[model samples]
Target: MPRNRATASPLFVPRKATRTQQRVARAEFAKARTKARAAQAPSRRREHEGADPELQPSYPASGRPGPASARGGRLRLPKHRMTTAVAGGAYPFLAEAGLGAEGIFIGRDLHAEGSFCYDPFALYNSGRIEGFTNPNAILCGVIGMGKSALAKSIATRAIAHGYKIYVPSDPKGEWTGLAEALGGQTIALGPGLPGKLNPLDAPGRPTGVSEEDWTNEVRKRRLLLLASLAATVLKRDLLPMEHTGLDVALDLVVADAEATETVPLLGDIAHVLGNPERLDAALGDQAGGLGRAADDLAHAFRRLVHGDLSGMFDAPSTVAFDPAAPMLSIDLSRLGSSGDDTALVLAMTCASAWMEAALADPAGGRRWVIYDEAWRIMRHVGLLERMQQQFKLSRGLGIANLVILHRLSDLLSAGDAGSRGRVLAEGLLADCSTRIIYRQEPDQVQVSMSLLGLTGVEAQAIGALTRGRGLWKVAGLSFIVQHLLHPREKPLYDTDFRMTA
Candidate 1:
């Protein structure tokens, strides 16, 4: 049917329809198209500028800004609803901006599809991310999720940035190869092994400290080690009198070792603790009858000296500490493989103490202390307490601790809720400003969400993450990254050679 002439703005407009209606519709179309282009890539946005009269089309571009479609009906976009995450693919430019291209290049940001980089020290120093107050970080993932590879990548890449790596205790001994490859040192400690570590050894005084101050500092550290060992063995905290006894025993050992001009050994301290009379007399007029107080403490240290765990930490250290070493790790894979980890925990205590003493120097340059298999240590309050100190002092020491675990629930297993072990475990989690979570089993998603304070969506994302990918939460910001491996690093970081072969 032929119709009367229509107004430009509307198909059924009266003859009296004004030109303002047509101008208004065109104005709205231009405004909406401008907004759509604004969300596009910068390069795409620039395409709208400066048209060439020769090559430019005389008609408008596709999805033309007019009242109707070229098919003779009003233009309409077929409405479809989808999750923003799924829609992001069709709108790639609307993803996260990403944590800038600085520090160690980890891999690629899954959402942004851009390079991903991370450096705790760099991020802490930049002051870009608020709530990122500490340099410490924790990583959790189920087995085969590549958490170890990510950790190794951080350690290997960090070397180029003038940072030192220290694996205070390597349970699996896997880091031995990586440490050696980086031209670092690894001390394997076990029964009948030649390597020995004396936790009482004093680190060289820092440049500015006075001699007297260094002496006192060494004494304090030694006392703390003794108390921690006793606590772990006895399964309880030391009393004031027991603390006094340890203090007395350590002073006697230090005095004798310094007089002999020899390094102090754990056996020396254990020996003094065994003789309460000696500890009592050492205190002189200050105290007496302290022998009874130290009787139990003696048994605690005796395990490290003359018991099954002897020969590892009882003798003088075979190798001296190299302050400039790129990395240092103690291998305890062969030891404490039994069901009971008491012996392993004790060894970790002594080894960590030695490393902590060396790392006490603030000017040792930036360092990373990776506590691999940290879940094993979380059960003992004494270990957690000692580990807590490292985390608390990490910022001042210019050290970052990367604590790895199999799942977030590992923290819950530290102790019953409101218990000391639980408190320490939660405290450790609090101190870590960065948390990297790899793929998890379905049952683990709830634990990850509760412990890490992740939203339902984030929790869901974690359960579905594939290998070599993780959800990184820096400060309060979050990112999903696919951990890319280098060709050369594949051989070094691979832990699946046995199954693959």
Candidate 2:
């Protein structure tokens, strides 16, 4: 039946193969496929001949080319060699980010490897500091340690930023040349000099102030100036009676000036204090013993008009104060060498009052009221009180008062222990949130540390700071900076000209 079916349908049928036969067929198929792949390998290699060497497949080599040898077994990284200090500094986690770059370019922050900048007004307005409401500063360093140079750099640099400087009292006249160079005015005052300043002179009034307010301000300034002058000369505070006498004399002098339409001078106040009838007529029954009580004050003022301190401040100011000037420096060098510290103090007081009048103008822009040789002025009660007032009103007045001193000891020497002078002197430092300390002597380390609240590292660093380097503390942050000076500023700010010469 099968043979008949194959012949009839012409069909074919297949049977299952044995295991040995199946294996032989599979091996033959694998051999054919392998031959096909081998034939394509040469062509694929030729196509990839121009490919990047790095992109090519990598294979394990006999030895890796590194510091370790094949005999060493594993690859090893080269060991780094450095001192502990160097290694510590190399770690990014141990470094400071530094004060964000804003403000006047002061110098370089040695630690942060960045520019150090500072501007009190700018910092305050920007809220870079917390709870610091005043734009005041203290720059303390030993003489010849570049404190003055740094101050000069700040002032000179700030001028370009539209800031005006008022050096109320330059004891050494160091700022006179700088003022002139900056296209500012410098008023020189001394014995036998033509320069005269009247502290009682009326200040430029702010716009929108009432006449009554203006009159009251002038009266107040005059009274304070007279009292301060008397106190400075007397080296003791005026008694209540003396104050009353001064008030009476000032009132009479002001009244006469109002009627005469002429400014009153120190002599007029002295003249009125010496004449009891004149004061009695002006003050009526309220002038009891005022004239006699004012005798000491009058005599004290007489020294300004007729004594060694005469020819300056007894009459009207010969040099006009141009507040619009870039800078104003009152040169007291002539009196500075007179061996009479009182003369220098008096001159500074008068100059300050005269400039204050111009500063009273609300239109008067921001200014830097530098108190160079601050130690010399702080010893005087009158000047110290004036500085305290200035510090309190710094924000409202749009001014920054820079108090420069030779050492912290200068502050300690301000007055006897627990005296008002001492309290006020310390108060000055307290008001100034920005403290710059240059190289200090070893003995000053304790005082500087306690006063400034510096860390042991900072305290020790302060003693070892080299020239032009300073420790800057602002708000709660601190930096050790190296001040960079412009070549042109060197001659202008050099305090060692005499030594060099």
Candidate 3:
């Protein structure tokens, strides 16, 4: 009975859409699907562009979760996929955990700041980075950044560890305290002057005191100084005196200088001898500029040996050469000159002294030379390649070299930027296996940081690092760390300081 009453109540009840209307709705729905597909298919519209997830905008806090947030803020990442990649732990932690941070460990201390910490291994342990395996260490930075202090620190530590150290002192009186502070002996040797010997001086009988001996020492110093200057001017390494006709030419100049007693520029004879081929070429030929330069070098030496070149050797300079020393620091402050000349003289003297030392010891354990402000000597010494060659053969001779420079452009000045010469330089760096890169400017920082293939976070940390702080890349791992500054080395905060500048 209720159904019968309701049968006529719904005249206006809606009917199903007509076929045409339904078809229109379907068409609209299909159009919308196509639009959605176009919006979603990003790769279809763009060519040549990479899909970088990092470039994607972060979702609103209300919209999505980040990896960190999704992971509940667990900062420790999982083990690196490769066996060689470092795992999470302190420097010493790796070794203790049996994972081994043997190469170079860039890790954090409790304070959260970064630091470089190496393991202590036996002296004969070739795997250990200690003991100057390369026989070279460069400590370079602008004035006041503790360059000297660092030298003192390394020198002191090396000495305490029973390594001999030779210091070429400056007038700043930095090394006078070194002998006492480090327990090594220091003997000052200038062209001819002998001052107080610090306790750090290597022990040996007076080699000799004959007039001939003194004359030879003085002549060696003069020749070294002259050769350094000539090499700088020629922009190439000079042939050693033994193999060329240059010895006679040098003798002539020496005799002339001794008679007139005046050091003359080798360039003065350029007209007499047009630029000859390099040393190798000169050796192949009987006549050329090489011969003329040799003659001029001898003349200059003669003048220097007598009293003609008086003030040239009078910079209040002194160098300490000893195979027993673990380190050698050439102090230029006492030379009374801070210009290129002073740097060249000191570099030449040090190079000659080092050569002599190496020759004296056919089997020294391992010798290292650290040229701090490399550009200073290199600006006029033209010894960059020579220095690098020494580094190449150094491991064979138990010698290692650490060359420090403020900029890459310094190497460019020596030769063509494209000249694979840098490849050799890079090879030397590659062999280093351990590298510490400090804070750098935009240009250098970009290139330097790029080398390690750093991630967004690591690159950011490196870019924001402050003075005495840097990224350490050793073997393959890289991390930012704060380095310990030496007390004796000046604060590297000067206007032109290497790190902050």
Candidate 4:
């Protein structure tokens, strides 16, 4: 009976089911598939999560993806092809990290695309630049190349920052207008001018200095001034007798002033030189040929006081040297017509002596002593020696000397090759760790390169620089700068008026 029922059921089974029966079958099939997926989910997760800790794939300490694994791996990146020139902009290795922005704003750095600035005092104090302990600088350029403009801009801009400027001698009178514009004073010294400076006058003593120390300093300065003047006029260093004679005469003049509490004049020293009796009394038997030896020295003093160089520094200063003033310029343009090298040297000597008095003050703060037309000043051996002395003591005196010249060859011309004068001149250049070179003649490039130790690139740049553009070498770093000028500063610093006119 069971076999017969099964056979009938199989044959009678409908090929198609009714709508309600089809819905129930579909629902049951979906429920069975969902149960199967749910059961497989944990197994798949465990396959990923159940790895042994020690055997798990390791990544580099940098956290970057490791080598490929069976499970997964990092996506591969395509190689990039680019020229070095295009890549250099993104990673600049040849660029110069310029001198940090500090001190005075001079101009823009052509290489670094930013402003350029220079302050020797700030640099020295900050110690940011190595091997540049000295605060001196040399600026060299041909005429109309903006050397003077740069000098004036530095001086004028420095005035606003409380640094005093002392232009010992302005032979061309170029600083007269600038001095007046800065609310500073310029003492015009020439044949007809009423200005007079006494080289022997005691300098203003620094505070905390004893009277004895002050007196000794005054005597020392006066002795050096007189000796330097004599040597410059004679075109030779002073002999032992001349030195002794000068010492005796300076001592007497200073002694007389100390006794009378008055300032001595250059004529006073000349008078003592002419009269040996006073020196003999002071030296007692040690004054051998002192008077006779001083004849040339006396005559040199006479030339300064009552002779050709008279009326400028012959007597006591008619104008007071107010050290409180922001700037002081001695205009020697009047003596330019004289064409007397000795006279200019004497004027510079006296002006330097006068400034030394103010510079003695420890509280004078930082100051700049600019030697414009430095080529002319370096020619005189005595003046060159004095400049060397000042440069050596610049840090102690809290002063910086800026020498402006036409070329480095000007220094070589100071004396014969290998001569002491030449050596001293070269030493001056060596001491100046900062050198600003403007456009130069093609012929001068060799000398510039040799003297400044410029690289081939820098040496070649010297001749191609335009007006107001300069190659600034600070310490050991190099930068090409375009000096900027304000509209108001144009009229003040313009040296091309003649051409413009």
User: What lDDT tens digits, residue by residue, belong to model 3 across residues 386-466?
Assistant: 465555665565544445555434444444545545554544454554454444444655555454455565556545566
Q: What tens digits encode model 4's per-residue C-alpha lDDT throughout 253-344?
A: 87787799887878888899888777777888764546577788888888887888877776778888787888889898887555557788
Pairs that clash in candidate 1: none
TM-score computed on alpha carbons, candidate 2: 0.80
- lDDT tens readout by residue for model 1, 334-355: 7857568888988999999999
Question: Candidate 2 has which clashing residue pairs, if any?
Answer: none
**Candidate 4: residue 154 lDDT (0-100):** 94
Against the hidden reference, what TM-scores do the models get?
0.81, 0.80, 0.52, 0.80
Backbone clashes, candidate 2: 0
Number of colliding residue pairs in each model: 0, 0, 39, 0
Distance (Å) between predicted and true CA of 218, model 4?
1.5
Runs with alpha carbons beyond 4 Å of true place in candidate 3: 1-115, 119-151, 166-176, 185-229, 233-243, 248-295, 298-328, 342-362, 418-431, 447-460, 485-501
Clashes of 4: 0
- Evaluated at residue 161, the lDDT of candidate 2 is 87
**Native-referenced Cα lDDT, model 4:** 0.83
**Which candidate number has the best lDDT?**
1
Return the lDDT, model 1, position 417: 94
lDDT of 2 by residue, 244-320 (tens): 87887887777788899988888888888788777667667763545577778878989988888877887877877
